[model samples]
Target: MSAAGPRADVIDEHVAALSAALHGPARAKSRLIGEIRDGLMDTAAAHAADGVPRQRAARLAVREFGTVDDLVPSCQRELTIAQARHTARTVALTSPFLVACWYLAGSIDQGQAWQLPRTAQLVAVHLAGVATFAALFAAVALAATGTLARRLPTPRGLPLVVAWAGTTASGAMAGAALALVTAAALATDWPLLVCAGALAAASHAAVAASARACRHCARLPVT
Candidate 1:
C-alpha cells in the first residue's frame, strides 16, 4: 500500500483548539489566532523546505508553541482584565442613570413636577456626587489594572494601589446606596426608596465582581 501524505486537517484542528483559549475583543482574538496560524504554517513550510514531512512539521510547530496548559494562563489573565473592564464600564454607565431615576421617582411621588423639594435637592446632589466619584474611580481602577500593567517583570506598587482603589470605590458606592435608601425611607418616598435600594444592590454586585476580577488579575505572576 502507498503511504499517505501529511494531512493539513490535523494541523488546522490543532490551531483551532489553541485559538479557543484566547480571550479578549473579537477583533483582537481573531488577530491572535491568525498570527498563530500563520506562524504555524510558516514553521511547517520551513520544515517542509528541509524535507521533513508536513504532518511532522505541524506537530513540531505546535509542540514548540507550547501545550494548551502553557497557553491558557496568559489568555486567562487577559480574559480577567477584559471582564473587569466590562463590569467597571457597566458601573460607570449605570450610575448616572440610576441616580437620575431615583431623583425622578422621588420628584414624581412628591407632586413636584420637575422641581425637587429642598431636601430632595440636597439628597439628590449628594447622591449624584457620590455616584460620579464612583464612576471616576471605576475608570481609574480599570486603567491601572489592565493586562498591560500585569505584564511587568517586576510587580509595581501601582497594581496594589489600584486594587485598593477598586475596593475603596466599591465601598463608597455601597455606602452611598445605603445612605440613599435610608434617606428615602425617612422622606417617606417609599416607591423611590425601593427603586434606590434596587439600584444600590445592583451597583454593589457589579462593583464586587469587578473588584474580584481585578484582585485575581493582581495575584497572577507578573509575566
Candidate 2:
C-alpha cells in the first residue's frame, strides 16, 4: 500500500505535464490525455510484471513516452486538425438555415410585401450565391480534415485555411441577411425585423467564436 503511492504520483505528474503542454478543443484534448495515461499505465504494469519495482517501472514508462518537447508538435498538429474539422462542420451545417431565416422572416411578416429595388435585389442574389459556394467549400474542407486525413498525410497550415474559410462563409451569409433585412425593412413589421436581426447576430457570434478557436490552434508553433 505504501509503495503504490509514489508509483501513481509519478504517472500522474507526467500526465499533468502532457495535458498542460496541449491546447485545443476541450473534448479532443481530454480524450488525448486519457489515452496517454492509459498507455503509460499499461507500460508500467508490463515492466512491473518482469520483476521491476512499481516506482521504477513508472519512471521507465515516462522515459519511453518521450519528453514534453518531443511530443508537443505532433500533439498540437492533431489538435489543430480537430479544430479545423470543427470549424468546417459548423459552416457546412448552419448555412442553409441562414438562408431560411430570411424567407421565414418574410413569411411571418405582418406588413405589406413591397418590391425591392433592382440594385438591392441583384446584390442579395450575388451574396446568396457567394454564401452557397462558401458553404460547399467548407464542406469539402470538413471532409478533407476528417475522413480524408486518415488516408493521407495532413496538409501543412490546414487549420489556418479552414478558419478563414469558415469566417468568410459566415460573413457572406451575414451580408446576405443584411441586404435582405434592409430591403425588407419597410415591408415587414418591427417584430419580424427584430427576430431576423437577432437570429443573424447570434449565428454570426457562434461562427466568430469557433473561428477564433481555430486561429488560436493554428498559431501555435508545432515545431
Model 1 reaches what TM-score against the true structure? Answer: 0.57
Model 2 ranges off by over 4 Å: 105-128, 173-187
- Per-residue lDDT tens digits for candidate 1, residues 1-223, read 2112453665688767866755444554666667777887788778777988777877887788777668767765555455456656665766675466456445634543433343544555565566677677667656655554577432244444444555655565565566556555555455665576567667667666666655665565433
Q: What is the TM-score of each candidate against the true structure?
A: 0.57, 0.83
For model 2, how does the per-residue alpha-carbon lDDT over 1-223 read when each residue is reduced to its tens digit? 5877877899999889888988888999999989988999999999999999999999999999998888889899889888888887787776665665555454543434565522334554565566567678788887787788889877877789888877876686667567556755665454555465456556666676788889888999885
lDDT, model 1, position 112: 38
Clashing pairs in 1: none
Best-performing candidate as measured by lDDT: 2
